[model samples]
Target: MRHTEREPDYIIKNDNALINLENSVKSLCKHVMLRQENEHLKDLVIDRNKYETILGNSTPVMKVLRLIQKVEKSNIMVLVTGQSGTGKELVAKSIHYNSPRARKPFVTVNMGAIPEDLIESELFGHEKGAFTDARDRRIGKFEEANEGTIFLDEIGEMDLMLQTKLLRVLQEKEVTRIGSNKSIKLDVRVIAATNKNLAQEVKEGKFREDLFYRLQGFLIHLPPLFERGDDVVLLSKSFLTDFCKENRMGNITLSKEAVKFLMDYKWPGNVRELKAVIERAAIMSENLTIQPEDLIFANG
Candidate 1:
């Protein structure tokens, strides 16, 4: 007898189920791709804002801006030297965010803030049970910054032993964890900043001479605010506008007397001090116009 041939019902249902699963996966992948695109656009916007924040029209400030534009695309070790509050960290951020590594991680380590005993582990990571507080495996800043940038702020404060280790990492492009013999290769760009005079420190045997040369592959010196001339008024106005908006206050302007006072005063704390003074005046001013009397100087 010839049997009637037909596909079983279960086989047909299985085929439909597979087709639905395939469609679901495609939908999930599309969502993931769209999310990634949105994140990239956000990063672009942030980078543009960072560039704009380094504002000034004075010759000295313009020169620094030009240098930033020139070096943002290259992978080089930058040493930014200036007095305290001169915006050395800002320079470092501008370089990292404007460069090709903009999309990558920007890790910052304040050498002055980290304790000497733990700095090595902080930079190179450590294995589980590596030390007393090591309860789990930890990844260090350098590893986290692979294919990105690492900003070493207050680098002059680092001790000699750690400086030697840092020099080795720069030379070899690799790092060995605290308790492991294996080495992990890295592709991080390093940007260091300091308010101290590293050259003087090197001469005094407080800093390593070899490491100093290595870090100063390119150096950018930030002029103090007093030397920047009329840029003080420009920055003052900008800060005033920002503080006003942030506090939801009406628009404010500096009186002629106030402007003169700002221009004449010596900015011992540099741009940082100027910003603080403006913010205080913005809050303390009785009217939309900020007067000379509203300005307050920090104790010398």
Candidate 2:
């Protein structure tokens, strides 16, 4: 007679053990995710501190620093408005380097530098044979900046037609190559900088009103050097120290008269002009201190 196969009661017990194992694995995964998030927060804090050191502690600069701290964690579009040389690109860098996507690429495109004919191809890329000169497939700024950030400098200079395309990118998060009918999806964060007043450009009909609104989700206006009060002197000293260190020269100090002249003259080129002036003074100074005569003004 054939013996009946034994039905093991431990099968039910084994099912319970499997459920416990699954629960334990889920708990471990949750713990790992939480730890990663905490590390990211810690990195963000460190980045904020680094930016604080770069941007001085003057009231206006401090205000901007605080704003950077608030916005760096989010992926919102930012519009930085200031005169040329006011460190708009620096501000963009600070944001990107502090965000969750800090490790990703930070692509910068100078809207004013590209020719009108090639601007579209430069931004949205092209197929290998898209244009007459097309020898190889080219990736666009948006694609290069996938899952990262794209800084559009001199955004006001973008043509009206291109503005529409950019607006579509911001809305749809996708781009189509010039010769291809297919659209490539992107996860790019846009940060635009402009020396021109986009509001004025919009009113003047030179800029698209819709695009202006889209880009200006959060606006940061960098004050000119003259308006920054004591920041001029602070920045001058900082630049001097940097120049000295870079050249392997002894420490250089700015003379009282040199400080007076720097404070008195308006910096038309903003911080960039100030940096250039200080660098020149550092190089030209025969003594350890920068004298008034050593400080040359471009306007003069």
Candidate 3:
């Protein structure tokens, strides 16, 4: 049978939700194209290696880069753990794109955003007339990502019931659709990410212990932005320079005070927050330079 990909359930459920996911993906890889006019901002920040966009030179970041290289050569499941906004998904994509499966689909399933009821159907396809809304046979994310990679973002948020089924797939390398007796085999690399402490969740009887172990067979923990040393300043420079070019505001450099302003304050929201602040500062500051006063935090 010829394979087909229908519009995903999440896309059909909410347009804004889909847009937000798209934006997050772009934010990691294509930071330059926030607006139609800023298309030239593409590749403005990082090196020509493109998807090697996990920008930083801190010891912590270097360790992450090393770990990514180590696991990319093998088909081991990787669990990326970190605080929110730490770019865990970007790390996962980097591993996938660098691995042998680079040419295959890199399907992403945000287990956190999808409603509990629809998540199962979203992960595992449903047969036509399987349920009231099962109007036609559907191919889920796993099937779509066969011979590639499937990123289960916010995997810790998945309900307990589905976790058992997911564990079985991880062990047996096959998935049985919601209303089918046949088991469809998959050759997909599973990369899961979450901001929550899954070990604590397991201790509290929330997450499946076995599944947690399975996912973390190869773990990559991203250090918080504050712990990443001068990376804050590096990201600040890249963000400011790119935003100025994108907006045609010219080459606005960050002042010494502004550099201190970025480095001294703790970035609780990590790189994502830093990028937002830099972009805002670029617009709020003078055309020539970004001053300390131009920088503003969401809390401030």
Best by lDDT: 1
Q: Where does candidate 3 clash, by residue pair?
A: none
Give me the displacement of residue 157 in model 3, in angstroms: 0.6
Sum up the clashes in candidate 3.
Answer: 0
Give the higher-TM-score candidate: 1 or 2.
1
Candidate 2 stretches greater than 4 Å from native? 1-53
Candidate 3's C-alpha runs over 4 A off are 1-52
The prediction achieving the highest TM-score against the true structure is 1
Q: Write the per-residue lDDT of candidate 3 for residues 1-300, one digit (tens) a residue.
A: 122244555556588877888888878665544454353343332223235578899999999999998999689999999998898988988888777787677899999899999998899898998899999999989999999899999998898999998999899998888889999989999999999999999999999999999998999999999999899988888877778788888888989998988889888888889999989888888758889899899889
| TM-score between model 1 and native | 0.90
**Candidate 1's error at 74, in angstroms?**
0.8
- In candidate 1 the C-alpha lDDT for residue 195 amounts to 90
Q: All candidates' lDDT scores?
A: 0.91, 0.89, 0.86
**lDDT by residue (tens digit), candidate 1, 1-300:** 122244456677798899999999999999999989988886786567466588688899999999989999999899999998999988988898888888788899999998888899999999999999989889999999999899999999999989999999999999999889999999999999999999999999999999999988999999999988889999999999989899899999999999999999988899999999999988888869889888998953
**Ordering by TM-score:** 1, 3, 2
